[model samples]
Target: MKQQQVKLISLVMVAVFAISLVLAACAVPATAPSAPAGGEAASTDVAAPEAAAPAADSNFKPVWYAPAPHPYFEEVRKGVEAFEAETGIKVEKQIGPDWNQDSQNQRMEALAAQGFNAFSVYPADAVGTNGLYEQLTPNGIHIINFGTSTAQPTTASFAVATDVKAAAMRAAEELIAAMGGKGNIINVLEVLEDPNTALRKQGIDEVVAKYPDVTIIQEVADIKSVEEAVQKVGDALSANIDKVDGIIATGYTPSVAIAQVLSEYKEKGGDRTIHAVGIDTDEMVMQAIKDGVMDGTIVQNPYGHGYLSMLLLQYLSEGYTPKADAYFVDAGFAFATQENLETYNNDILAVTEQIKSELLDKYLEK
Candidate 1:
């Protein structure tokens, strides 16, 4: 009986020892030095663990590719140019003939063969683009999506673009406000092939549904080009000219198309006061805002999309790695009305700077 008692006490002692060790281990983290060594001042602010600074990779060749030429892409090209000037890293820039998945695949493969190690691409097709990334990544090629992202489970390292759904929702809110909270809207969208269009469509529809007074009179999709966007938007407006009180376009092509059609409508003495909100500050779209032809456009940081993607690619090539949190980097956007048309660009630039400052902690692990 005495041996059994001793054994029970020994087991309790072992349990207590184990618990004490765990407590001690936990307490070590909680106990921090109150003062720095050698009488140095201690920091009051706790900063995130700093990632190692990336080494410059002069030999890495990166490409900034677009599926087609548009004003939005032109702005993105300016950012690419800025990156080239800033980094002294020459980018092999290429523009595809059209926004087609097969074209993107062929062009990217050709570039890859020519020794481009990094690419900042606007996926020609959101779902289909992943196949290209899947092929490239295993071969040591790093791909970044500039304007839009592929569908989830992407092989691309990062996507530098505006939050399309947020931008679209904002556009809806702006449109509804411009129409005095009640209107029949003509919703113009770009290609249905890109999944961003669906997110954008959902964003717009969700926002409009909140206000019972707002109704989408006509919604058009699958506008593949500026020509198609213009013709289709014009037709939609004509068909609902008497009933349409507002037009909202969340895609670049459709936005520019809306600006042109509305400007013509205003010039042709169309008596209907159609308030329009569109995406991207194409020179024509901005001019429309300035000329009072359209209400406003959403100015996304296309420059940031190009510049940051290249910057990230540079880091990636230099052996810097992305944190798990670093998936979609929101370049940001602003409503470019006549009020801020000239200076709105400054706001977009600020967003880029803010993201850059946070990239080490918020994005890249190393």
Candidate 2:
């Protein structure tokens, strides 16, 4: 009986051990495969937002075409640089030789073909250059005329330069004051066909009309060469040496020529100590003012003219239409004598540098 009981107990213990082993197998958890080393894991979490894209280019080109190679080009170039610096827009300029109408017209057409959207011109002749404007306007190009006016006024943009008439009048008034308000004067004018010259002549006429004693003894026009200018002025001075007390030159080239004649005449012991006053800020004119050869000159800031024209063009491109009043920016001219030459020179240089610095700061990235 004891042997049978022991056998029963062993069988029960074996059955319990087998059930326990099956339960342990069922409780074991399954393991997933590991990701490869250095590989990113797939995540169900939301992704981070992307960075913003850069701005697109406007693709608008601004071109400047001046009629002649003159100081005006340098001023325009500076203004163009200022505009580009401020707006990140590039400016292309073409300066044609004096009176090169055919070349200028051809160049304008070519630039228009190259996708130029705006142009600023100093027209050589009002009648001849109107056709160039007609061509440009049809192409949806903006045009601004500097130093001259157009024959047929169009809705297209135009800047009548600092009251050139006022500038000349101011010059005349200053001359009259320097000569004790009474003197016989010789007026040296630029090309008679030029609108600028006509306006200046009107100013002189106005001032001279006020004082009966201040007579304009001679008016010479179309004096292209300096030699011819000197000859004409010399003859006028010699003929009226006793009567002529002052000389007024209405433009840059003629002014320089007049100064040369006056300087030579003065050295030759001519009795007439001519109080010379001229227009525009050519280097020769400035030097003459410094040397006391010229009593004074009316200085126009052509650099400002170029600078402002580009600025106006940029405004138009940006969809801002100018009010009639804002269309004309009167960049005022100053009278420069030996006393004021240093101040004017410094002011111009400083303004130029400031314009450049402002341009770089506004347009370029640090």
Candidate 3:
């Protein structure tokens, strides 16, 4: 009986052990690995950092250098301002005291030291700017030569200026027409050595040669100051009173002086037979035209010069290369006289307004 009881106990123990093993096998999961408490496996594959965005392009600031202070400089300033307002770029202008080469060089050097990238220069002396070109070009700086052309143009990106020869020729033709194409005309010219002055004289000479009866009574120079010009013109008028049938004053200063003397002469019972043509648009010349003291004057579109200079700079900055020949911009002129003075006065204002609008719309709209 003792042996049978012992066997029963052994069988019960074996059955309990077998059931425990089966339950352990069922509890194990197929998709998940067994984990120790509070621990995780390391990941084999990691993602790279996102790429950084590219930076924006930098802005370019150019400098403008004028030879001297004049009403023309004011027009240039306006054009530069318009460009800056439109393009989000800056044009810093520095006008020299006069047509002094040394003063201009100093200004240029100072600007260069300030790290200016480009320059638009109206050189006082064409030959003198060659050295400047050499110095600036090596520094990766660009240049635009305006108003005057230098001996070496390879140093500059481009040039834009008036057709001085054509305008002067037109002035001569107008004078010849006023004098019936057959009379003695005196030319009150500026410095003869100046390229502009020379071109104008050539034009006058060419047109006057066409009229066989017309002759040049006298040619005067060094009449830069108004007083000096007036004195020279007065002496010429007094000496050749009968032979002088017409007068052509070539520059603004001379034109104003001649107009003043002619006005006084007309007021003091002088004969109104002498016709006059003047260059430049001084108030005195305008008044003379209005009062019929002068027949016509050649007016330069100074504002156009200013506006176009800025445009040329912009084109160059965009990696443009101009043709071999110089770019001559035709800033149209009107023969201002008593017959068309009022009409031209309005036309000048209208054209300036149009230039302003274009500058704003095209350059500033960025």
Question: Which lDDT values do the candidates have, in the order given?
Answer: 0.82, 0.68, 0.69
What lDDT does candidate 1 reach at residue 60? Answer: 94
Q: Model 1: per-residue lDDT, tens digit, 13-41? A: 99999999899667642114332111011
Candidate 3, 1-366: lDDT as tens digits: 698898999888998988888886785542134321110111001111122211211434488889876655655565556555555566787878889888888889888888886787887887788788888878877777766566654587655455677878888899889999889988988876576888888888998888999999899777667888899999989988978999998787888888899999999999748899987666678778878889988765554455556665665555555554544434455567777654554454355455444432343222
Off by over 4 Å in 3: 1-59, 152-154, 326-332, 345-366
My TM-score estimates for the predictions, one after another, are 0.80, 0.76, 0.76
Candidate 1 Cα misplacement greater than 4 A, ranges: 1-55
**Candidate 1 positional error at 350, Å:** 0.6
Q: Give the RMSD in angstroms, all C-alphas superposed, for model 2.
A: 31.0
lDDT at position 249, candidate 1: 95
Return the clash pairs for model 3, or none.
Answer: 86-363, 86-364
lDDT of 3 at 10: 88
Worst 10 residues of 1 by lDDT: 36-45
Task: Compare the candidates by lDDT and give the number of the best one.
Answer: 1
Model 2: per-residue Cα lDDT over 312-353, one tens digit each: 566556555555434444555667787866565444434434
Error of 1 at 286 (Å): 2.1
